[model samples]
Target: MNAAVLALLLCLASAATYATAAVAQERLARREATAEGGNRSLLRTGAWWASAGLNAAAALLHAAALRYGPLTLVQPLGALTLVAAVPMGARAAGRRVASGEWRGTLLTLAGLGLLLLPASGPAPEETLSFSQVLVVAAASALAIGVLASRRAARSGLRHAAASGLASAVASALTQTVAVSAGRGGELLSARVIGVALLVLTFAMGGLLLSQTAYQGGLGAPLAVVNIVNPLAAAAIGIALLGERLQGGPAGVALAAAGALAAARGVLLLTRTAAQGAAPLPQARARDRSDLVGVKPAPAPESATVS
Candidate 1:
């Protein structure tokens, strides 16, 4: 098979693995308070641990994709995790997704697809100082991730912010790797240094953040962290590195539209949590008692939405 085909397959596999992990991690997070002595629930159930494993698999698969595809192509495709996570949540729990959930999912995927399509290249690749760029990016990422971690020491939101920041840096670096590998026409060269730095700085940071985020809330943090990562990378690719699409202004405009649609979808999904939107089958009349994936128990059923 060709590199592009290989890259596509890797991207899909990574999405599936990451989605599965997200589902499992959410279950563990819901049980956090109830985990007596603050012991790990997933230690026996292996939910969090399994999620970590799946996340690792995803990072590796993503690396393989960069080896063969353009960061421009591979970076946008990371959005597939969003597509993967929701349906997987539905299927694993033997639950029916509500119309709102379905609508949110579709809108997200539609907008992301538009924003993330691979632009066939017609322009010469640009090059810059390898070590200096990598060093700067790495130093910046470390500072941000560390500061976020420290500031968010006791807050779930802080941890989420830290994790999300790291994840985004990792994703951008992953794409940078693919670009670097391609530039040198060899995996190890001066051109490849940027890619290596991207991995060292961002991907490494992502791993640490993933652990913390998965410990908190699965759906919200996963969605936030994973989504932010690629958006950051794609933005940097276009703006900082002068990456261009072959189809000119129309392509750029369409890409912008797609991003807006996807962002709208994300905002709607976020409101589900923020505005006290009912989650899953509890809101649905036919929900079963034996829901497979776990989440925090509902506030009193009698509790009124503000």
Candidate 2:
């Protein structure tokens, strides 16, 4: 097979692995409490570790895909993780996949394909210098700090959005590191070490935030991550890596439209999140009418996007 075909297959596999990891991590988060060390306990859980392993595998495959394909082609395919997650999540929960979900998945994939189809071609290899890497790192750090400050104690969307943004910057940093590594320079060099540290920081932050996002709900958090990761990575590629997308102004317009369509599809899928998917609200007042000593009522339920 040609390199292009191989790259496509790798991208798909990476997406599938990422989907599996997301499902596993989200389930872990949904069932666990935050007081259990704010996602740190996940390190001890067998399921969480297995999911992390899958994520590691996916990252390796993603890097390989990048080696053979343009950023525009590879990053857009990452959106497929969301498409894959819906069915997998439904099946795991012993629920039937909704028809609207199927439609949404198709729409998301179709729009992503349209957005990326014109971007066909192999990307030229480029290595970033230490200064460039430092700049990227500083920018990502600033974004993460801002997101962290804005996160509320009870808002799942805030947590998830923060996580998604962190993950997006991490993705870009990963690309930069990968490109630098491909140059086969001294591994212990300051440049490589600096970039690697940034990658680790954002990646871990993203992972923690993503798990927290499950506290808010499944589909919405996942949707935000899926949307932001690729867009951020692609933007970095265009801005820093000097990769040119096709069709110039027209391509930009098409990408914007396609992004909107994809976001809509994600919204539709959010409607399919399991009943009571979000975190429970604060407990309510006890009912005085109970014969036995009144017990506080449970918090109200959360609804997925309607």
Candidate 3:
């Protein structure tokens, strides 16, 4: 088969794997949230480890796709994870897919397609120097620290954003290591080893952050991570790696519109998720009564208790 076809197949497989892994992780997060003590060791959870394994498999598939396809092709296809995740998550939760979730997912996907489609040619082949790597690492750490701070209100969304930034930085470092290795540079050199170590550190950090994000719900948090990952990676490519967007002024305009659309979609998804997560009025009243040491009023005879 041709390289493009192979790449397409690999990308699809990767997207499916990613979707499944997301669902598993989100379920595990929910379990951990509701479990007593809330301090259950992730290492003791079989599903948590299983989800991590699936993520590793998906990464391998994605890397293989890049081998046979250009970034312009492979990167946009990664957005399919969000597309697949919505329905998969609904199915996992035994609920119907909501209309707003579908709309938000589609909008996010369209915007990502537009945002990634402007790179008309291959990016420059380059590797980050040790100093450049340090700078990038510091910047990513600061961003993640702020977003994942305890003061953040939308804990899930903030954690998801932090995860996205961490994953993006890790991708950049991985690219550096890949380029260096591909060019027959010294793999065991101090610089290369240090870069490799940073890659692992960020990758693991992102995984933990994403697990936390999933505790809120699937659609909105996953959308945030998926949306931020590529945009941040593209920004890194443009600013630090000598990459350029195509079509000059027109491309810039298109990318800006895409970014706006994606942001709006994320907002819609976040609102929808929040609405779904709100407590029922009856439940809220009952909880309030319980708080004051009063019993809730009895329900009507015909009313369902649940």
Residues 1-306 of candidate 2 have per-residue lDDT tens digits of 776888789989998998998888766775565334556666766777898788778877887887777676787888778778877876655455678677767777777776785566665376567777677667776776666564443556556667767766666666666666667765667877887787778777887778777765456667767766767777777787777778888888888888888788767766655433322222112212121246756544663322
lDDT tens readout by residue for model 3, 156-204: 9999999988977877777777666766756778998999899889988
* Candidates' RMSD to native: 6.6, 7.3, 6.1
Candidate 1 at 304: error in angstroms?
24
lDDT of 1 at 249: 83
Clashes by residue pair, model 2: none
- All candidates: TM-score: 0.70, 0.80, 0.84
User: Which residue runs of candidate 2 sit more than 4 Å off their true CA positions?
Assistant: 33-38, 150-155, 186-188, 274-306
Q: Candidate 2 — what's its lDDT? A: 0.70
Task: Choose 1 or 3, whichever is better by TM-score.
Answer: 3
Largest lDDT belongs to which candidate?
A: 3
* Candidate 3 backbone overlaps, count: 0
